[model samples]
Target: MGGPEQQVFHPNANIVRKAHCSSMEQYRQMHARSLERPDEFWGEIAEQFHWEAPVKSNFFSYNFDINKGPISIKWMEEASTNICFNLLDVNIQKGLGDKVAFYWEGNDPEDYTRVTYKKLLEHVCKFANVLKSHGVEKGDRVAIYMPMVLELVVTMLACSRIGAVHSIVFGGFSADSLAERMHDCRAKILVTADGVWRGDKLLHLKEICDTALDKCSKIGHNVEKCIVVSHLTRLSNAHTQKTPGMKPPVHKTPFTPGRDLWWDDEMKGASNFCYPTWVDAEDPLFMLYTSGSTGKPKGVLHTTAGYLLYAATTFKYVFDYHPGDTYWCTADIGWITGHTYVVYGPLANGATSVMFEGTPFYPHNGRYWEVIEKYKINLFYTAPTAIRALMKFGDEPVKKFNMSSLRVLGSVGEPINPEAWLWYYRLVGQNKCSIVDTFWQTETGGHVLTPLPGCTPMKPGSATFPFFGVQPELLDENGKIIRGPGEGYLVFSKPWPGMMRTLFGNHDRFETTYFKKFPGYYCTGDGARRDEEGYLWVTGRMDDMLNVSGHLLSTAEVESALVEHPDVAEAAVVSHPHAVKGECLYCFITPNEGVHFSTTLVAELRKKVREKIGPFASPEVVQHAPGLPKTRSGKIMRRVLRKVALNDRDVGDTSTLADEGIVEALFSNRPPEASKLLKAC
Candidate 1:
């Protein structure tokens, strides 16, 4: 796909760890053992961690049908253990306290913090004690909305120590978005900072959280407190409070009677020796909400045992992690990749990693290369989007680094295009590293499908195959699995540990959304095909989504904001690929009668959407029209719009359109002036 449109041989191919799995002996061994002896393998993993009490069944059989079917796919069925005990306390007790656990870097150039395993234990224990003093107890849901910082990690572990479920919302989400998650879980305590500094901008995070709370009515009765941490202190509201550092016997307010204290102050009451709350292997540990375009986001709940097992397993084998390897996953903590790899997976393996808070292009184009050289990193994991972005800058920036320490390279978030893969392989890896193109999702928990380092044959643009315990299937619309080599819907045939338990509070929705779509299987909402050699090629989403430059952005979410404007009454969105990005947005705006179009107006509209949503949701083009193609139920016919965006005349079935005349009008009156502006929705 790059240069000659043919794959070229890399000199480092033979040196790759694939020699250890040339025959796929390791893959076959793990796959056969994990599948045939699922219980024994998982049970063994559970025993590795300290437990408060032993459980009856190491795993509860995954049952789709059960009256009390909420995360029933549990592990260590009857066991009780605190996660903090395994993540922090035990490591310290083993004399690993002095070893660096996390090296945190903030967007601010001067912001850098290093935390050792022992100090992490103390912070987590101290914070756990603070939560208890503020009436936070077992079974409570705490919402953590903050920028990528040391406090975020400490908060999650602290909650784990106290047996409380933590729902971490990425800091950039709008207030309405924040409220949706908070209300869904009925979070008793909201932990947020005054503001967050991203590059040069200081966003008022707490103010946004406050505005979001105004729209939430579900947690009115249960919500008890708001714990605010000072970031850009000036951006805070009246509720914001500042403390020099976390200490005991801290001041408290009577607002919640038992709550309303600084994040640092709340931790002093926590005893460093306080034991982590005991948990069943199947207990719901954390709830992460995905960005849903069609409806309310689903709260993908993950249990402790099964999740820990999969996360630990993937981290160990995927990157071929070793004690001295310095790993770095360049993704925000908001996505599943960050939660599992950046936090849980790497730490569980006792491997040191870098937590980056800034963007790839931030400060300079050489930031990532500089970080690797500075830290002596061996494993570099990032998305294809990032690779391509850096590719545009050419190789001049990378020439400054001495990157010989690099060993393994990985790609996640989406399938890496063949062109990007090869570019990353040569430009970044310098023909000296094995590239693992990973493919999975928020629901898959850890890496479900991939050619792990030291395993499987190299395939450009292919995800390779399913990992251990994964039974990959290419299903048709009727839910029939296509065999051998073919294209169809991508689905998982069996239940895995990291699969989401439910759709937050809506059980029926979960069943209808995932189960009903494909009987007896998990619908991945993706389209994939296997090659003759058994390698899988991912086409794109079966659903409506424009993966603009590899960042999954929804047309509906964009159009909804466009319609919010008084001039625009309706809109249809689609994509058209460019040479750089895999795709670009195509927006067809049906403005109100008498409203004319102009390049200035279209540019303003795009800016408006950016203000409403974030910069990532901005539209590339906006075309004003009289009407949009839609169904009788008021659903936009995206298939036709996609064709129109690509400048094609022919399209598929249109009898379903609510207004067939609109399509004709869109084509007949294709405004010459509008095309000149070429604003894409």
Candidate 2:
């Protein structure tokens, strides 16, 4: 993680209205079905999607009792079909050749583009050829380092079309991050662009790629070549050329290079595409790494059949997608949310999804609203952090849009505050839509716990219910499952189709990270509680579980209690070392405007947490601040806060931090060590 160079100013998003949902009863039947006769329920659901070869047995088998762990897994075990066939092969024959798969919205609202199934297939075909020309093959991993663009999507589908395994590294990742992933996968081909533009700034992606390739043992030797799209490959030369067709000699000279090939040239005469190679249903389609701090990024391998089945089913259910509807998930494809929802999920269901290539607020604060207006986007899915940021600007810019097309709203990446949830529900959704705050991870494939638009009643801050096949349980420390809504470790007591097979080449780590935590149960890295109403609310990661005098406490609970207060806009709580107690509680608070900050607000917040939860949950210290540190996805970087709070004095691994400047701005105190250390020590 880069230190001191990553913080960016963010504005809070306005959220209004509130999502209301009912009893967990009707959802219970589905759970009962998933448990008792899983084959019947899930097998029927899987039938809705296109499968090349139909299996005779509905479910081969399913089981997961806490003692057994992975409570249930339905294997259409005998079925053999490529996921690409489901997305591309079947759609063509139905004459949905012109069906729009992706509607792209760039930072510049004017730069709109659409890729139909026919066009997407052609690009995938051509790119598959390009990959083959460069020596890519089935099982030989390929690395794609590109931005949120059409070529990136094309590269992914191409990998699946040719049965090649792709490992996507998000464009914003540093060379060290990219190099680590490249070495882990030992990819044969590297797909990258020279550079990319984010709002007014240009990112030197190709330069970073070249630098990463130098250190990557796999790419340095095994990598055939790097495929560079002719983007402004460097920040320095971004504005050198006036426009693409302009008569600029120096720019034209480097537009296409000997080692770097232009996408325009690569697609010409590269066939309307070769036939998609069919493989075993279990054959890995791609390996999308998770957000790891260091070492090797967890190469979460997703296979074709199980992955497709889960994404398609969960996408349709969680968002309540209607045929011919426009869905927008403003996430980069490098992450799981982007991989499954942005691409595979919508495409499998033959729905149109908008792929945004820039920040929500770029050219103007109204960028997001403008896209919603222009696209008439029906279902808009984004992160909680983004919503909180937009809340700062109030409802002014959002009023500029005629967002009648928006029918459903979604929150992913992290648990959204009820206040921000209400804002999105009111201002953006206009009370007519459903705010389905979903919870799942890269390892889980699709949304495991979420509200299904018309099916489940949504609780403002709650993730609501488990997806069709998932069986969720809240467990206490002694390996006993907690029945009522109480804070504890979150466990998926069964198997999910989209679940990661292993942490590529590291089975032991996989077993240790997930399974070992709770024998027989797939320990979700998060801690959650089922409310009295049975609505599930996620606190944060398991490691985020704090110990106060040996009592397990979650930062989520305290933060949630703080946000429940009218004046408190946001909060981040972490453990600070105490001589007597192993770790004491400390919180950084952000108050809403028009509310004067003083000792009174801090006292009020502390009392709120104490009265609402318990006196033991009281914060030892509460400091009101302008803002708290967060990730790009909106998750509070409490780890950073913990280090500072404990008087470590060192600002740790700031590269992962969305606001590095906030570190210095927040921590005025100093530790007896060199400044800006990358480790916790």
Which candidate comes out best when scored by lDDT?
2
lDDT of 1 at 414: 59
Model 2's TM-score against the true structure: 0.87
TM-score of each candidate? 0.76, 0.87
Runs with alpha carbons beyond 4 Å of true place in candidate 1: 1-23, 55-60, 64-72, 217-222, 233-260, 268-270, 544-681
Lowest-sum lDDT 10-residue window in model 1: 1-10
How many clashes does each candidate structure show, in the order listed? 15, 32
- Tens-digit lDDT track of model 1 for 244-289: 4433232222233344456655664557766768877667789899
Tell me the tens digit of each residue's lDDT in model 2 across 406-459: 878889988876777878887998766777889998888989888766556566
What lDDT would candidate 2 get against the real structure?
0.74
Provide the overall lDDT of each model, using Cα atoms, as 2-decimal numbers: 0.71, 0.74
